[model samples]
Target: MRPICLPERVAARAFPPLAPIAFACSLALQLSPARAQNALSVEPDTTAGSVPLRVLDARVRLGGERVRLPGRENMGLAGLTELLNVGGEWWVGPGVYGAATGHRGGLFVPGVEGAWSHPFNDWLAVDTGVFAGGGGGAAAPVGGGLMLRPHVDLVFRFPGFYTGPTFSKVWFTSGQINSNQFGWMLNVDSSFRYRPADFHGTATDGSATGLGFDHVDATVTMARPRNSTSTAGTPMTQRIGLVGLRAERSVDGPFWAGIEAAGAGSGGVAGYAEVLGTAGLRFPVVGDRLSLGVRGAVGLGGGGAIDTGGGLLVKASAGMTLRLTDTLGIGAELGLVDAPDGHYKAETAAVSLNWALDVPQRDLSDWFNTRPGTPTRMEFGTGVERYRAARKDGRTEALEAVVLQVNRFVAPDVYLTGQAHSAFAGGAGAYSVGLFGIGAQMPVSQRVRLGAEALAGAAGGGGVDTQGGAVLQARAYADVALTDSLSLRVAAGKIKSVHGGLDAPVVDAALVFSFGVDHKH
Candidate 1:
């Protein structure tokens, strides 16, 4: 069969509008944004140079459930989990691979996951994997609290599309008061990889090569004309060298699009990765196995790269691809690039290795999983606390203190908390007072939360009327969540000095930032 190129007029109509949400949450998980470009380096069982490692396989998921815990009523929690892991993997068989990633959410979950992908034929496949993690937390006082997830994927290989069902079990902890707490959830995601060969004029199946593929190429800029003419009036060819990775999706027709982020900063240029969005057309020449295309894009050029006011950029290019096999291929392109306010421009050319990411060619080695997220909400703040009272001998005092608070979502509208404060002002000067206690918080709205606590720790610093004595404190406050982990607070409380026999009042405010996750439901 021969691959055909669509007429320019017809190609323009090939793309149809898709829903906006269609752009997000396409898979239960995506190995990586550039999974295919990195596929060739992965091997099923090769002692290859230092085994492959995956660093920070970050994943984000939406949807949750409400469950009942021992001694507690049913709590409906908005399910949101953030994980970071460092691990290695090995291929088990023709359609199977296993990997372990250290996971952390509200609790510590570290486990292994395996996938078995069996091709129904060359165009379809079935894939399944089970993921598990175990670790210790406040609830899992002894053994590790665990998490298990099993998923199934139905894949359309030719188009590189996959979708399926996923089920998961998230555990809390095992403690003396009760035993354990956990939740169950189910969700679905779908997405497709760009198949360069599938686009109009890209190429046909079982080809030696194809046009329109994701690739990593090395480029050499042979000529860069300067604003001022040379003595001889000929443009000098500097021949600057560079390398980069390009991911594209021309899945629909002759037009393909994707992001290109590559780096080159050696030889006095300042390291920078040129990232751009591209769209283009393909023309088939010999049969359906080889084709040529032209692409145009505009984006910012940063990383010290020469750019005008805002680092504006534009690139016009022509390229060709030849498939050596069903999955392996080669490509080269010549481009006219202008950046940094169009002050810098060059005529560039380069070659690339086109590798398509698919089940049959996937090899997992030194891959990693890590990322930062607010798994729980903890705040650190600063405020001024004061006290006032009546009594012939009762004294009033004011102090500036540093406050630290930790909280967790317990119910839709409530939170459990622990707080501490160390005073640096007031009559005691430096060695003043310290307050610590447990309390509760309630969110009155998306941004505001009301709270109260009682604390008693140590009191007294150097002074004629001083000696260390027990300090008692209590307060009520209102805090507003500023971001995923930040907040601002206003509070009022009472303090009593046991040794000085005085009653004090506290009035203060603070800026707080949470270090972990907060109530989402």
Candidate 2:
């Protein structure tokens, strides 16, 4: 069997936690009121019946854990997460964890977690939560890639943030790894602001909300390993293909900062992935239609038999872009990848399509008067999905996962969406996927609506056969409104590999929360 490892740096954890937590917190603080207040509670206390959904809070945290490889090899993992305070002292968000020590190079996990914070006094607090996700690449034994972590932290509160030590357990339920470890965490507090889901289709004075990011890019990248070494002390010859997404905001004229994530989709290197924090600058070369730029990134990655010693990585690149429209562009770049703690090096090239969103720039002085721009319609929710017999080795068991989805309506009946899924059952742990596309829906009854969506993106790991890592799926779904802001959604679809033999039927159920923001563009 090929030595399992992970991919290069694009996004996710390390360094006692992921850096994006701090990065994301800073962005939120820029859009928050200047007054000092508790980060855990942004809204006044109210019963759940009075408000279904609203802006909760902004938080950032870091953690660490220890794990065991086969043959008694040991490794340490650093984890980081950024969360949205959703009221009731609860937080929900995404996080990344990667091997920070020992011999494991591409060991990483990216997944979602929900946490609850309780205050014991004005100066002390406690946090308890669980994380669910998947990943495993290099010689790591995260069988099926499913991982569960339950942790607690005791923290000391300051004016705007809190720090403390944490204790937790790491369990790969269907795999060959389980351990208990100690770590640390940090949480930042910020202002709260959000309109209810009932306002999803109404107009509001354009204000900045969410991360307040100004640009996004969808990219396809190719990396050619150059004189790379495997864990077994042999030369690596596989050229890897990747799919990625990046979200960015301008910090100054011609300069920007962003976060990105990518996964292997080709080259038979499934289970390889990366998450990175990036900074770059762009200068106009041909007026506003063309530009040239350079960027640098740092984060954790490993897996796919590639030696990423301790899963710490950094990259530098230079490139150019051509504007295709006011909101879209095409770009290309050349870069070099290096692992400071491992034996991995590569020459990389990529092509990307970019979008400029209409939102407030990264201005820190305009928080008190800002009102977030509203969309015509929007839906955010979580659900569960299952894939029937989708494994590459011809297994018959069904693969089940937890999914998160966001849908935005561009027209009255047409919408665009993005989704992420992490497998938790069917022995397919550590398998994750990201997808984006468009859909259309229409109301068919007083309380019901029907819709269909076509999506394409990248998937890998957990022994699933997503050839070259690219996949296409289409789903038809029905929605029954439970409240103005809440609904029940059920969908059925088929997912097919664009380059391999895995074809399967899929079904899912979700609790969707709908809201609208007014966009003044």
Candidate 3:
């Protein structure tokens, strides 16, 4: 998802209706000048000549509406430290963030962030940074975050070309009322972005908001090839290529707005479309040190060969970066995306602590290691399980059952497993059972893997018994990364049973094939 950015002028325009109410309250305060004076006396002095100090600033935001999550309320906190250079052009700071459901605070996350700034010749300067942290308020333990952003600007001194640095600064100088009166004050002078290849963070503003940078904008992404099937059970294979373009304007001040269009090709799915409008705002958090801001977009026109029945697509987010020392700091974000038919409705909150080392600009391969050709891997597995049937009266004796298994992974983290079982009894005829199972795997470590499964089959007399279970399996036997697409696993654990089985002791092993999304931490 992208952060939502509002233009200074637009933000200024949005203030009028709400300003009267606030101004009236401000006037009531005038009645107590003595109290106001006393308040000022106790307030921390933020003067240009004060000694540099760390200021702790945090925000708790709660937003709930009919949109997005339907009837759910979303809330989060941005805890940060703003390093002020009370007297210089360079500033830096870092902090952490966490968000959760409004009803329950049980699911909580903590993440880190950092930012830095150096003014060059007053009119031009460059800013660059990164972040890595995690925990979605909903799945705190498994959540993660990471981001990298570096940007430069050519400041135009004249109002004719560039807008002022902040909305507050611009409005104070021109004395012109605008829609988003406080819009500029809430921005950091940098772009909001993430690396898409790793799925470590959400898409960049261009991809999320359908906005562009400069007059010409381009984007491209490629994932390792694989194969899978749709929910409708259609077989599909994929060789990835994701690309797009758009038109953008470098607005004055810490803001920009544009329009964009992009397309993706993978498996049997292909689609393209144009975004309506997108905008962003960036400004320093405290002086030239820490930075924070928002960026967002809404769909406008163009529906392509693969339309998800588009009505509206929107993206919004808020982020902060802090500079800890020179090479390390923390960053965090709260983002959301909503598209037609719930195709793009995802609320994501993440934080990261990152350490970056300056590397000379080099070819793509210098940054990423890749094999000259595709690698082929194979795996074979088998396991035995026992199910002790419940004992009845004297007429029947307890039954002991055993199963044989086999599985294979056709792609990364995907598998197909098969099992056969036979039952032996002291008082009845020996009966047999068969099962075919399919599932997905997520590896957390060398000996731990998390997975969900669905299976269907019949027992003695062809009595049907279908089951589904979520497995948190651990390999008690071995530890090794077998291959890019294959993992050697030996696990034993209880699964959340979804079917009725007579106290089945699930002790079985088989080769497994897995596929689908990878949630990385």
Candidate 4:
């Protein structure tokens, strides 16, 4: 087998004071309101006549312990958040995010948001929301102000609808605001959804696979953010925004595929529209209580800061909901994140706990359609390899190898996996044995994981071995799940092998590309 080339550990240093300063002036918006206040409430409103319609409820949170940026003297927090809700003809919420892992006094901000929804009946609803807010940390010179925004949303259920307009503006405190800083956003989106009872031989509700008319959605958006630097002792910012669209289709139970396009620029209008595409699978495990999924995407675009161009993003996640009683339940999520560019990305594994209030018991069909419970599935892969002997006059050989892996829950904190490698070279067919192992997967975040494994396998006839030997390995794998199936994996491992009276030590590193399934139970 070819030796796995490990990636060098790139120290995650603190961000430069100037970088945070630049981001603050460019993207700083607002502090996220606490979740305790926003979580969905089950309290019945006697004044409203009936329980309000649960139109939408979604929350995303990202952060970890304090860490320093590269070549910077600042120590701050790193995290992101996005939340939204539409109920009883009113839509209210906020989308707040920031990277404050730098200066002693970091920057923080939250944008304003509001929306009005009008239900024309049980099937159609028209809604519009606006947001405006901005702030800088203790580093602000003028205490910074807010940016006003206005946008609308139209919803059509079952058959769905497409083609609507969205407009927004960033009104700054003064003209001194960078050119790249001030601009507008214009967007149009159209989507169609279909959920048929049955299609072909695949039942839309069972059998781990569903078939229906492919769903499609298209969106185009334009934005401009000032991007400039001080030249004559005056701060200058440039203005830029990319326009792009994405289309996707989800088969009821098993798989989905999507593609996206967008322009790039720190200021003004982007010159190139970057394109990304992905496809993957999903499956359920543990009697519909857990799901497993994986996915990968490739970027095709320009390079440099103007683009960083394109690369890859991948992730995998598994989740389960525990019912404590009829009306209350608890849930958990564990996953990974990985990206090629560390500056714009980093791999992470995360786990979260949530409590559900007054959740209704889902039927088999509804359970199959909803995607909230999924398991983490192990991935197996194979590739070619070449080995160079250590002694002089030693021959160089090319080999083909197959790798097998299985990731599943063996118990509460323990996970089991097995792998085997077979190779062929020269006139001899050498197989490096089968590896049976088990370990614990400790989640640190939505994109990072720490694991250890022990194995014993036999070598099929490669000179230095007899029968089978034992090996112990510890590995850290960082993964980023961009979608249900596509994910990027960066891992490092150290192993010690003992056989026939001799012990050999080995170290391996790999930047692996993975594509697989993500399913919800």
**Candidate with best lDDT:** 2
User: What C-alpha lDDT, on a 0 to 100 scale, does residue 291 get in candidate 3?
Assistant: 71
Q: Estimate the TM-score for candidate 3.
A: 0.21
Clashes of 3: 62
| Candidate 3 lDDT score relative to the true structure | 0.31
Ranking by TM-score: 2, 1, 4, 3
The residue ranges of model 1 lying beyond 4 angstroms of the native Cα positions read: 1-225, 228-238, 340-342, 359-521
**Cα lDDT of all candidates, in order?**
0.39, 0.71, 0.31, 0.31
Candidate number that wins on TM-score, 1 or 3: 1
- Tens digit of per-residue lDDT, candidate 2, span 1-521: 67433211212222333354435435443433322223335663422323322455677565555565668787878777777777778988777777776777666666789999899899999999999876655546667677899998887898778877677888887778788766655566653344564442323443324444567788888999887887777887888888888777666678777777777778766666777778788999998889999998877776655677777778899999998765568999999998887888899999999866543222123222233334446677688889875667866578887777877665567777877776677776656777888899889997899999999887766677776678888999999999877899999999888887668899999989776433333
Cα deviation of 251, candidate 3, in Å: 3.5
Q: Which candidate has the top score in TM-score? A: 2
Per-residue alpha-carbon lDDT of model 4 for 129-166, expressed as tens digits?
55544432222221222334344444443321221222
What TM-score does model 4 achieve against the real structure? 0.26
Candidate number that wins on TM-score, 1 or 4: 1
Error of 1 at 275 (Å): 0.9
Candidate 2 or 1, higher lDDT = 2
Cα deviation of 73, candidate 3, in Å? 37
User: In what order do the candidates fall by lDDT, top score first?
Assistant: 2, 1, 4, 3
Native-to-model Cα distance after best TM-score fit, residue 509 in candidate 1, in Å: 37
Residue 176 in candidate 4, Cα distance off native in Å: 5.7
